[model samples]
Target: MTIEIGWKLDNSYVNNLPELFFTKVNPTPVSSPKMVILNYPLIRYLGLNVQTLQSNEGVAIFAGNKIPEGAMPLAQAYAGHQFGHFTMLGDGRAVLIGEQITPLGERYDIQLKGSGRTPYSRGGDGRAALGPMLREYIISEAMHNFGIPTTRSLAVVTTGESIARETRLPGAILARVASSHLRVGTFQYAAKWGTVEDIRILSDYTIKRHFSYIEDDENPYLSLLKEVIKRQAALIAKWQLIGFIHGVMNTDNMTISGETIDYGPCAFMDTYDPATVFSSIDIHGRYAYGNQPNIAAWNLARFAETLLPLLDENQERGVKLAQDAISDFGKLYHRNWLTGMRAKLGIFNEESEDGSLVEDLLNIMQKYRADYTNTFVALTFEKLEDSSLFSTDEFLKWHRRWKDRLSRQQESNNSSQQLMKNSNPSIIPRNHRVEEALEAAVKQGDYSVLERLLDALSNPYDYSIKQADYSTPPEPSDRPYRTFCGT
Candidate 1:
């Protein structure tokens, strides 16, 4: 495949046998196409020619003003359960332009989120505000550096036009790359609106593409469910350890690939509160910090529901099998959570008291309103060397017990400190910092702050002195934190 053609002949999604999976659509031509940022690392990673990508033609293609040669643009059709209510939803503002197969032979979905109207626009203008696109770009890249599975930004382009949400804001498009655009809700859509044969076809295609090891299994659909459950268990556990709040855990946002997707209104916790909710829409705390593991299990159960017909020939047996899969979610999540928590606390060996040790530390953290990222990062430093950190009567009490537990293990202090350092990140995309970046871009049309914050976050583990201020939590003046979906 030549770089001028942009992609190889294999558009598996298009060549595949289903017209119901997507609807053919063309991206509406924009007024002026301008490049804002191109992810050089990801471009090279995907093995695309950088010289071609930065050319004027590349700018037009990315901005959705011109379709690339041999590209098949379409809007994907999928249903989602929004906020516990099942509603038919599709790509209201986004379009999947094509799937790019890397020189390494791995395929990823190349999507234009905030690219204009599709068949699924549903009475809303198909456009994106600059802030949310920028938010997704920052957080998703940060998540990747944090060693988390995530959909990443390949490029961001300006439409040189204005979009109105609450008011007139600059329009932008995020060229997002993902393992695939398939989601649990994709299966939900198939099961609800498509034939049983369609569901089976989706299951087989999913297995062949992502889980070929399970292709020969006696019950591939059931096996797929089990594997998804396992990945989600591990992923959610990582989120808990790192204090990430996805904000919206709706069905469509949950990917079947188990990678974190749809970074709308998501925030990392500053204070260690189980009930922390930053999304302005999460009024009842349904997707709160402490509830992620359980919510993941719930989402998987819905996924299993979509696979019922393919799970087994007999309905009762299928229900039982799915129930067992759902139960495994709890077991798997607990084990992964415990294993991750142990690493954060520098516990190499499992112990009966380990759970309580972890629990007590959290209790003390909540009591002290401790900054989540800083508290764990502090453990790696000299004991109490940073006296300004989470220091209190309750924290000291927990610290004595924690030290006693560590003493039982034969690992050297240096190794334990190394484990702490590796497991805990010194910085995350703090909410206040993110807000500052967005404010600069949306209001003053300044992107330098966004670039600077992205720089600090790109090396989250190193904690370089120049980026020290990025690690701090929000002050009281920034209280009552709120994030919008930017729809």
Candidate 2:
């Protein structure tokens, strides 16, 4: 198929920022770069020419060796609350090359992360180590396969030079695509500058880009805040249903578009544990698995605070309106979450106690310490009959409750079976598998393992043809593996 693309950079968003933030650009350089992986299918999805993107010259263009003709690289300036404390942070090691408005009128950023440093590079090397790059490529693609909204990896290029962290590791660059790179922290930065005019401008611009339905609203800023809160709550709740731990739920990492960004310290649960945290820097366990929803609501509160000036004319009125909007996050999250859980359990009708139904199942999972993926897989594998398919008594009890609820479900047995099949994935990027793939590539220079894992993750819903071993967690010997931030 012929892939077509058209791009227009919307410099209008950050047009009025300080010149130093935009004009002073210095990207660190790397040597003898090699193109390790290219997302050809995604390139076609974006309607770009694969022949050009795959060429040697295209490799240079992708690796930040040379910028594309119409592309403009600029680092965004934003502030974020890291571990509950606000800090000034921006794209320190990343640069937004430009934006592309697709044929469908969807705007996406063609960003070069690990390209080099900008003014935001806060006293650290602006390069990325190979391991993290590969991990993101694997996990991000896995997320997409699982039908999650995320930043897509366009390409991964190895910079021949070595980067020093705990060990000397090869450098790499990732070409990431996103709907928009604007974050809740972006609004926080402008709000902290204490410029109401800038806040209005930012709020108006965001409304146009994301929540255009509010363009004609009387209180557009308040409407935008409400819409963002709804989106974030739904996003976080989805993460919970899938057993995903974002690992770092800092305000800066939370994007306003509601797409999950920064796969630095992220993992799927092997066992049903609410407090699972894998990031080494997250010593306080603030962004644990169970805390993601609460963190999301907290970040939305910060976003609401930023828009207080434009939310209403009266300061008191604005505070009240923003609070009202932020408060709806819980209701919206619970509503969306229960909807998703119903699909998982194949319960189409709404129950007044749906949240309790969902919680009861989770309590059982916790009590049994059941494998999250396996439980769902078994349910989808067979109907509620013969609960013995699952190995645990705790699951059997939950299965009984599930069967009772299933008797009242509106969906036919066949329909429910099909819905369950679609809702629950058979495989996710297992943490140990990802680490093993990366280690093999880095230590033995074997890319086959990485390739195989990517192939499995590319279609997580299809377990029919998959090897039986990929669906299970790693053995006990492979337990306790932790991922590090490759700065």
Candidate 3:
């Protein structure tokens, strides 16, 4: 009989690394813990024995109160370039409890963010504040519902005690699910400090776990690099189409699995501005919306540098191969970005002058300072008669161009309109609404607003019957929201 209560980690990946990189360590103890949100769908999707994972015993295991049988808990090691400067960071306040082979025959890493301190904790308390923890839970779940590839949140547990951040705040931990925690920086950590053998081992293991199909290729290293670039470009284009600003798109924060991993200071834009940035630390707007494509290419270059030693026997030949592989990221990113923008504008066929059609709509939106989400949503609904709905009169001129473009495409039919409505989301996690919901939950323990927000967000593409308030942009009084690092 298959056991339901205990879990075993078939840790084949650990064999590739030195023991010192992941010394089995216990989490720092915390005060009272209370369960907040549990992701039932994910628990089932992972094909975890539901009886044990959802039981009180399972809740205890998830909250870090109990480590199940055969669980090899260890923190992952990695170095990252934070903002513009390189720094070594690891699972400072997070821990990989174990790895599970899901029922679908896929493998996933089970990790706990804010679990407690580890060897990588850089002289500060390794606990997460309530705000950031909840922010991740909200945004990650919202992204999943929006059909974007992202790490899923399993459960949220609040520590009774408080941690000091901008203020004394309550602490919480999030059980996060991912295809794998191996990142570009994971290889960087080894290349910069560990031996060449370590980089070779990591490359082999990464291929086995993520790109096993490329193993037989004579040039496996170059093929792996190209695959990572392709996936990241597609992922970033999805982010741009949805108006997500990752706030911190550091090298270490990126996952090789192409999932949107970290959600720190991340926000969806309100106004349709290309230069929008909300992360408090982003003083120079280096990771702004318009600059994400360039930043992604830059990060891929760094990853390319780390993999150079393993790419060829001769150092110079390897460097040349890596540069050539990284050069393809731009072409792939533009192709994916344009394809997505075409869908958003209801264009089905590729035309030589499609760029002008797309660019003109964006220019109009910028000139009008329109609400990004609502503008696209309004066009999907195609209620051009209602002019007052737009924040500016510039939408009127754009409406004509949008209609002219739609007329050229086959999707102008009634059936096409219906399909676009399903493709385009009417509601998203508006920044102001998210802040309002989270504040209410934290301050008063009133989850009604959070519940309502989730209800609206669940059917993002569908029109809500009585939820007009949730769809509208926040008033002038709720203009700015300051996001903090969950230190």
Candidate 4:
């Protein structure tokens, strides 16, 4: 089938680029290729000819069996501090095909995840299980609906092969899209292995691609560091406000594009506990819900270290500049978190005691172990006396204070209800529900549950009677929910 290939692309990483930035890799052809899903919206966004991908031959290209003419597939190299330990790591199972310039002039990386081994695969298979591949597809889309910046999935193609993990599972490839896959690890890798010139080249490339406004600044690299810090601060604050735990905050998982990357072992906290952790390997709770902001700052510090030479010629001046930028993360995250909290409380204006009022609600929530998502959802309504949510003396006391605080605002009740409804979603991808959906698809050959879940998740704020079950928290039977990296 000669599908008319309409690939408007370029390979900047391979053109006039040092070999150290990446390793040339060709994808291993699968035995049998099958189409699982295609993102029609993204297809139009990338300005691709839809006719080319609807046929069986398109599965071959998506499953990494066929490469487009202008595609230069390669595995990027990077190093990271994984759980406070420095290790050289790279794209072990992912391969970037090319940079697709959209019809609107925005550039994005099109990569195939779980497309077999590369030079970076250190004593591990590069195959991905269908469950985790689907897990990522579901979670990333949910995150997008939440208005968070994140990498998007374009397609998931089945390879008609079995992969051996904890159990033998069907293999699949995820075609992922992102502004860029460059991470803080990339800079670390360049600084550690490449010369100062290499680091400068990377800094320049990052500025040009993502932070173009600062390219002509007197200290463009320093400004770049500041901007990245601000982005990360705001991002982590948003995650905290929404009860999302990244599970793993390793430098390699932190993208310089300011988008959330790597969906492994991530979960939303059902109960409003700051120490909530779902990742099986995070025994110490280093990346817990409460510790995310600190971990993000620590990761940014490592990023700053890689920009020392580019920050300034004088070593002392550069260190001071980096420290000043890193110090702003706390103020930035606090302001961002407070702003989000104020909105969740339906307050249109800020007061000096607003922070304390927000803390009091969360304090009571944690004390009573209330459902995190439902508590805010219930606030948007007129009365809660008849519900199980406000049948406590402690909650009653706080509810009165909250109403008193709201009365001082300059907003109408209808507008405040709408704001609260928008700020607090009625539905989140609960860990137990996600597990159920994955179990049905991975073992039962049924994908209807997942499709339905995605449909319900698309409008999380809307209170639909049919989707009521998705809003409930997991019962005691689902206690101590555990997740793994699926490596």
Per-model clash counts, in order, read: 0, 1, 0, 0
Alpha-carbon local distance difference test for all models:
0.87, 0.80, 0.80, 0.88
- Which of the numbered candidates is closest to the native, going by highest lDDT? 4
Per-residue lDDT of 1-487 in model 3, one digit per residue for the tens? Answer: 1267435456655656786356576666566777777777787787667666666666667667777666678888899999978988888988887788776578888888888888998987878877677789889988998788899888888878788876898888888989888887887898898988888888888888899999999989888898899899998888988889998889998888889988888999888889998888888999899899899999999999888888898999999998888888888888887888878877777887778777877877777667887877777776644435454556666667667777887665675567567666787788888889889878887778887887787778768774577778877664465565666
Q: Give the per-residue lDDT digits (tens) of candidate 1, residues 1-487.
A: 2456356525677677388888988788889878878888898888777788888888888888877766788888889888899987888888888888888889888899999988888888999988899999999999999999999999888899999888898999999999888898889999888999999998888888889999999888999999999989989988998999999999999988889999998999998999999899999999999888888988999999999999989999999999998999888888988998898888899899899889988887787777888888888784565534446777777788888988989999888888888888888999989999989988997989999999888878786885788987788764598888988
List RMSD in Å for every model shown. Answer: 1.6, 2.7, 2.2, 1.5
Q: Residue-wise lDDT of candidate 2 within 1-487, one digit each (tens)? A: 1122333455544464444234335355667778888898887777677787777766776778876556667888889998899998888889887776655667788888888877788987788988898888998888888777788899999988887888798889999999888898888988886478777777777788888888999878778887788778878877888889888888888888889899998888988889888888888889888888888888888888898878778999999998888889988998887898888878888778777878887877777666788778778766444333365666667678778888886678888877887888888888888888999988888889999989877777777666456877777664465667677
lDDT of 3: 0.80
TM-score of each: 0.97, 0.94, 0.94, 0.97
lDDT of model 1 at position 51: 82
Candidate 2 segments whose C-alpha is farther than 4 A from its true place: 1-26, 383-394, 477-479
